[model samples]
Target: MRIYEKVHLVVATPGRILDLIEKGVAKVNNCRVVCLDEADKLLGHDFKGMLDRLISNLPERRQILLYSATFPLTVEYFMKRHMKTPYEVNLMDELTLKGITQYYAFVQERQKVHCLNTLFTKLQINQSIIFCNSTQRVELLAKKITELGYSCYYIHAKMAQTHRNRVFHDFRAGLCRNLVCSDLFTRGIDIQAVNMAETYLHRIGRSGRFGHLGIAINLITYDDRFLLHRIEGELGTEIKPIPKVRIPNLCIRCRNNSIMSWTRWSLKASCIPDKRSLQLRLLI
Candidate 1:
């Protein structure tokens, strides 16, 4: 009905939109602008064929925009084939965000749960998002976190979109303190109160929004050593080994001599007991 009403704007997944196009329900032939957010993933193996088919249905003269943090060779190739003389604005020289403190702990595969438990106990987290590489791991880790007595909710790409939206909204609204999700949640979603985050390179960016203080702790098993090195190399940032002491609220500005009252905490130095968690602190 909405399509028949000639709605000017339409947002949908490639597969669904393609189906609609084939069914003669949605018309993108007159779409003036086509924007693909997360273009890297959209152009990847899974959706590439559907996305190509969908684009084929669009008017050739339409403006197309591709946005993503990183563009792999495949995405670049796709852009070359689809776009003519596309102008790009690259804002990043380094991959990692400035306000995030990155730390890594080496643990055995079986000890990952224990390491996570240790992080939960030692770190001062206001709200946290933990990323698991797989959907199965996301569910399993969320269950383990719940069993450990921490409030947790999990989301994966396989879940219904409505259910995913509900979980995302509830988490953003502070209905829960912790969320476990697959890589689907790592892209472009901003939660200001999330001071603690766990995952790989892209996932770490979930914390420290717009120059705010945040911490990223990576629990790495032996199998992940090569991946860690590669990530460090690609990002051009070192992930220091976590210190034994617990750190309270970190003020990036404080460390950079922005405030006199906010005590500077060093990663190398032993920490004193403090009340401030990683969330927010009023420097007094």
Candidate 2:
């Protein structure tokens, strides 16, 4: 076996990746396209120095593609400094996201978990992820959900690396209906309040992939009302405040599956319905 293997793609944390680059062990001078998956989170002031150094070392004419959920002021500044005539694609407009529906439900801290549970029972969500702000909350929420007999799992930075891998795969395989996690879900890439609007958009973008219908629901308490309004104003999209409803006894998986089946059936019909029709019909 060769002691050194040739690599075409490399993924690692910032510090480690920077270490490799500094040592000339990870070469990207010939790279045709340099993509930053979480651009808004990474290109801000926090990573400006590292990012500028890395970009300075890359091919001068390489294509730079940045993907971020929310476009922010810092991101614009970063583009001005590093990117030339870069094109942009905005997912949000004055009225709505390109396709995603966002709801900012004001659930009091005491009823927050219950409200989440009620949503699971009511909505026909295919793949949903619930975000909390801390690891301890992730654990506590997961436990409470299981007690309610919901098929749910959680991932946080505190878990063993191996175990975290298993949980991620389980989620991708659709083994669980819900994934409860903390904002640490996007670790190493700083996602602070300044860029949290983008962070929320990024997380919700996880679901509703491949042009399928998706929903993003944020459960915030009174304290977070200011933050929620800030995000809404910045995005220029409405997060409809949904009234709290009683928890239903429906089987979430069965409801989700049935709804999906019906959607497929409808799509195959001679008169195909528009997106608005489907959304209104199923409230998916």
Model 1, C-alpha of 253: deviation from truth (Å):
2.7
Q: lDDT by residue for model 1 over 172-212, one digit each (tens)? A: 89899889887788666667667531125456654455444
lDDT of each: 0.70, 0.60
State residue 217's C-alpha deviation in candidate 2, in Å: 1.7
lDDT of 2 by residue, 1-284 (tens): 22156767666655566777789877778866777877777866567667777777788877878876556777777789878888878753321244555667666788877776666555444455667777898889889988998888898889998988888777767687667776656433221111126655555533333344545667777788888787777666677665444333322122133332332211233222232122210111
How many clashes in each structure? 0, 0
Number of residue pairs clashing in candidate 1, backbone atoms closer than 3 angstroms, sequence gap of 3 or more or interchain? 0
Query: Judged by TM-score, which candidate is best?
Result: 1
TM-score of each: 0.66, 0.58
